[model samples]
Target: MNIKTQLKNFYLLQCGQFVSQLGSKITSYGLILWTYDNSGSVLSIALLTICTLIPSILLSFLAGSISDKWDKKNIMIISDSIAAFFSLIVLILLITNSLKIEYIYIINFILGVVDAFQNPASEVAISLIISKENYIRVSGIRSLSNSCITIFYPILSTTIYAFAGLKLIIFIDLATFIFAVLTLIFLVKIPKRIYNTGDNTNILHQCKIGIKYIVNDKGILSLILFMAFVNLIASIYNCNLQPMILSRNGNNKFQLGIVTATIGIAGVIGSILVTIKKESKKKIPVILNIMMFSFSICNTLLGIGRNYYIWTIAVFLGNVLVPFLTANVEFIMRNKVPLEMQGVVFSARNTLQYISIPIGYLLGGVLADKVFEPNVYKISFLTNIVGSGKGAGIALIYIVIGIIGFLGCCIFKLNNDMRNLDN
Candidate 1:
């Protein structure tokens, strides 16, 4: 296919995927609010997150291997269909007044398993369809879509939850799933990878080959490790943000939604900026480190700021730096990794990066509830620094994690292998 035709087809696929994601995010946000309201425990939230992460992490390698063996479009369609079916089941349970916390955990676990296959398939599919020159720009565009989803989803979901509750929200998700499936089946045609007839490698051997490829490349391996550390620190903020904001704001759903919307707007602005700028061929690591530093500073500000307005600005500023960092990292991987091996390699990379996330989530919750929240009131020294309040302990944790993130960046800067990955 010509470049023009290829770009057209690629974007058509993205449009369908984006619509499905929009619906999914709305339902996700609504469920989060419902879970938090009913449980009122940070640990409960942590458990939900753990259930999601563990399945994906465990299945990532297998999923990646499967993606390489199958048609990417078919894998995605199957994954989305399974997820939608489960969502419908949840909706039925809700309508019957039998929806429980256990059900959400079980459903999230299943979705995570399906996503393990879907994510790598989708990533590899993009590499198949788009030209190398467009990787960075396309990454930015994808980020922009995510930003738009974040921007609108919170506002819409909160409003819906207030009036109609989860039933209507879930129905919307089911419809979007069908739309996405139909689009893939009819509108988008994904090119398949051709394997060598003489090669006949088993899945386990292919998995090892993918691992060896990364291990032999010190630069890429170091970069992945650095990112794993960064993700570990960031996960704490992710798990706790809602609880902190809700605790400080009297558990007001509307206020939490506003903060989320503001952050999403910042993300949209960042994604737009990245899309507009000409792509740089060098100094990617330097630019990524700079963005990470800026992000760290924003997190620090969020921790120290007492006013809601200040918190909003901090959230906005922090999210604004995300797209640039994410796009550059994606560009590196897409450029460095071969198309055929991307499914396994990307899965391996994700497994390494994501392993720490659940650890961070579980620890963040435990530290906040068991250690920090109760003791912050008792510790005179901490109280004097972060100030005394309900959410003060969580705020302090954010500051510590932010500082740790900056330190991780500094370490990355000092690592010659990671810094020279693009070169």
Candidate 2:
């Protein structure tokens, strides 16, 4: 396909994706609020996170292998269809007043499984459709889609939830799924899957080969390991964010929405800048490290500052640095990994990086409830700094995680393999 045709097709795909993501984000925020209000425990939110992540952690390798062998468009359509069906089921249960926390856990687990296939399929599809020269710009556009969802979903869902509640959110999600499915079926023409006759047909063997390919590459391997650590730290902050903000804001949904939206606005701005400027040809590592360091500092400020304005600014600045890091990393992957192996390779990368996420969620909750929240009274010196309150312990956790993340970035900077990856 010509470049213009390819761009047109990709934008269509992105439009469909953006609409679907917005709906999903709305549902997610609604569920988070419902679960927290109903259970009134951070652990409940953490369990929900675990249920959502565990499937992706377990099935990513198999999903990636399948993506390489199958039609990407069909995989996406089928996954979205299945997910939509489940969402509809949940909606029905909610309407009937039969929905429970366990139901939400089950639905999220199933959706995670769907994502195992859908994410790799989408990534590989982009690699196939777009020219290498546009990878950075396209990555920015992808970030913009997510940013738009983040920016709108929280406030929109919060407002809708106040009147229509969970059932309406699920219905909205189902509609978006239908829209995405139709777009894939009609508008997006995914290139045919490339098959290698010489390669083994065994799924296990293909997975092994994929792992070997990633591990044998020093640059990719180091980057993956570093990212795993980053995910761990970030996950901790994410798991506690809702509780922290709600605790500080007296559970005001509007206030929480505003704070979250600040991050999204920053993301939109960052994505626009990256899309316009593209990425630096050289100094990729320097850019990546600086962004990471900046993110850590912002995170630290978020932990230390109790004021709403401080919290919003910290979150905004932290998120603003994210697009640059994401675009650069994506560019590296697209350029370094062979097109044929992108599905499996990207899957493997995701699997490894996300392995720490569940651990982080579980640990964050346990530490917040069992350790930090209780111990704040005992440590007068520490309490003097972070203050004494309901969410203060979680705030302390953020500071520690931010420090660890900064140290990790420093270590990453010293990794010659990662620094030289794009060269």
lDDT of 1 by residue, 1-423 (tens): 788888888888999999999999898888888898899888888888888888998899888888888889999999999999999998999989999999999999999998899998898888889999888788888999899989899989999999999899999999999899999999998886643112577778777777888999888898788778877877788888889988887878888788889878988998998899876666556455655766587778778877678788888888887888888888888889887788888888989889999999999999899888888888788776677789889988988888778876776778788777767
Sliding window of 10 residues with minimal summed lDDT for model 2 = 193-202
Q: Kindly report which residue stretches of model 1 are placed more than 4 angstroms away from their true locations once superposed.
A: 194-199
How accurate locally, in lDDT, is each candidate? 0.85, 0.85
Which tens-of-lDDT digit does each residue in 40-99 have in candidate 2? 888889998899899988999999998888888888989888888888888888878898
What are the candidates' C-alpha RMSDs? 1.6, 1.5
Model 2 — TM-score against the truth? 0.97
lDDT value, residue 90 of candidate 2: 82
Pairs that collide in candidate 1 are none
